[model samples]
Target: MFAVTVDQVGSRSDDDRVEQAIDVVSTTAAGRLVLPPERTAGDEFQFLLDDAGTLLDVVFALARSDGWSIGIGVGDVEEPVPDSTRAARGDAFVTARAAVDRAKDVPEHLALEVAPGRRLGTADVEPLVTQTVRARQRRSREGWELADLLRAGHSRTEAAELLGVTPQAVAKRWSAADLRSDDAVHAALARLLTEADTPAGADTPA
Candidate 1:
């Protein structure tokens, strides 16, 4: 069996909600589970999965069922058989542990990438640092500032100029705001334009 963990997303502080969701996901499926948060931080969970793939499917199912978001990570096992080498156990557990910690702030539905040597790196894991930073910025206070500039038809370079900063600075800020993806930038611009078209204080949601 391999170790795995799932962490949920909350808009505010939803420690209880995260715990409840973890329990539901763990017990609903057959796995050796541990409540790390209950024992300590109240923000994470741990489990030993007989089949990692089975747990991953259940993780997604639980996220949908709870209407909450979750990030998942799995560690490598030296052997599929029980009681594998400590090195393998430590390797998988440590990497997965690190990924899980990072995922707490990442957007829902994005799985953590396993590092090289432990498990072959997945496409999902590349540039995760950039992705997570961008994800957080997209929902952050600065996200609003960047959105305003983009809606004014500013090219990224132009936006940087308008913001009185370098192009690299603009890209950094924009990427940090989670506008790195063209789809994300376009969507944010569309929302901003739509909002601007509305009268001020019209009681319409932004």
Candidate 2:
């Protein structure tokens, strides 16, 4: 299981965006969430999920916007799960809280934690995930525009037409944005996250 906690950064100075953020994440996380995201405290929200790929999607969606500190905790949740995230209990939630607090001070504003005595490989995986997210955060607006179009299933020619640019230009943007590298990173991160979540000596699905 994964528990994600997000806290609004600069909340005192910025306009309240909790609702908007929730909307974005909820959309990205639809059908995969164990508990629908909900505000847990002032300017903070939490959600539960089981799939690492969905967790990655949720993290990327949140990272697209500024002013958020994201933390993911991987571990077991107490059985007899509650319908509300706030009511959920276990090491996952505890570690998520700690992870979020640490995230506020991190360069990428993201962090990962594993319940003590579980998923010891998380130590190796977290840094790579953080670095990839940091690189993604540096992507330019033009890069994002092209990326969005391509991600929507538009071919380079189609995206170019939509953006009123040449296909060459679209290709240039894609290369400059390192979007190809993102694909590899995404696959690696998902696999790594799954491994990190798997307890030592436990059988992991191929």
Candidate 3:
């Protein structure tokens, strides 16, 4: 199981922003949630999941809209897991809180704690985000527009149709945007994490 905690940066300073972030997180996490995300404090939220596979995707999505910190803990949850974050009890929650505290100390916005060796804050998100930033920095205004359309699941042909351009033109912008490489990197990371989460001797997807 994976326990996760998040607190919006300076959310308490602006009550309205906290409310807005809560809505954003809710909307983004709807179908992906295991235990529904819950507000633990006015500015804090918590949830638990049965796997760590999708952690990166969720964190990056939240980071896009606003500033927030996240921590994830991989371990066992006590039997009969409750739907509420407050009602859940286990090493996972304890580790999650610790990781979040560490995240608060550093500039990075995310941390992960793994069990079996007490690997707290083992995953570093900086390199992944750095590559993304580099990719964004290399883009132009037109490139961003084309990239956004592609990111929304539109193919080069579809984006070209929407922009009234040739598919070749859209594909050129897509290459310049480097979103394919970024996505490939993310997909590789997700696979690695899933394999790590799977117990030894248990079969994992190839």
Candidate 4:
């Protein structure tokens, strides 16, 4: 299981954005979550999930806003899952708590913790994920607008039409945003996470 815990970056001074974040996670991870996202405390929310791809999607969606510290725990969850994330208990949840606290001190405001005794392969997953988030943070609003359209399966010409810009403009924004690199990072990160989560000696499909 994967446990994701998110804490607002500046909760004391900023308007509460927890509700909006919960909505985003819930929507993006619909049908993939082990439990519905729930507020764990003021300006904090958490959810459990099993798929690495969905985990990336949820993390990317939240990281785009740059308002939350994200911690992902990859490990085992105790049997007989609870109905609510707040009620769940396991190594995944424990690591997620520690990971979130660490995220507060990290430059990228993101962290990942694997449970004790789990051996991950050679890939440096956290740094790759952090770089992707940082790239998204650096993206301009226009870049993101084009990215969103492309992500939703729109062709470059169609995205240009929607944005009232020429296809060349959309292509330029796409290259400037380095979205191709982001897509590659996404695929690599997902594979790394899945590998990390697999039990020792388990066979992984090619």
lDDT of 3 by residue, 1-206 (tens): 67778887876575545556656655766667667678887678887666443566566656555477777666667888877878998877887888777767655666666555332224543355434534455578778788778778987788899999998888787787776676777777665555545555566545
TM-score-sorted candidate list, best first = 2, 4, 3, 1
Off by over 4 Å in 3: 51-53, 117-148, 163-173, 199-206
Which residue pairs does candidate 3 place in steric collision? none
- Candidate 3 weakest lDDT stretch, 10 residues: 117-126
1-206: candidate 2 lDDT, tens digit per residue:
88999999999998889999999888998888999899999999999998888999889989888789999988889989998999999988988888999999988899998876654555777898898888889899999999898789988889899999998888899998998887778888888888777777788747
| TM-score to true structure, per model | 0.42, 0.96, 0.75, 0.93
Could you tell which candidate, 2 or 3, scores higher by TM-score?
Answer: 2
Identify the candidate with maximal lDDT.
Answer: 2
Query: Model 1: per-residue lDDT, tens digit, 126-170?
Result: 343235334443455555466567855767777777778788877
Q: State the weakest 10-residue window (summed lDDT) of model 2.
A: 116-125
True-structure lDDT of candidate 2: 0.88
Regions of model 4 farther than 4 Å from truth: 121-123
Runs off by more than 4 Å, candidate 2: none
What's model 3's TM-score? 0.75
Preferred candidate (lDDT higher): 2 or 3: 2
Per-model C-alpha lDDT, please? 0.48, 0.88, 0.67, 0.87
Deviation of model 4 at 63, angstroms: 0.8
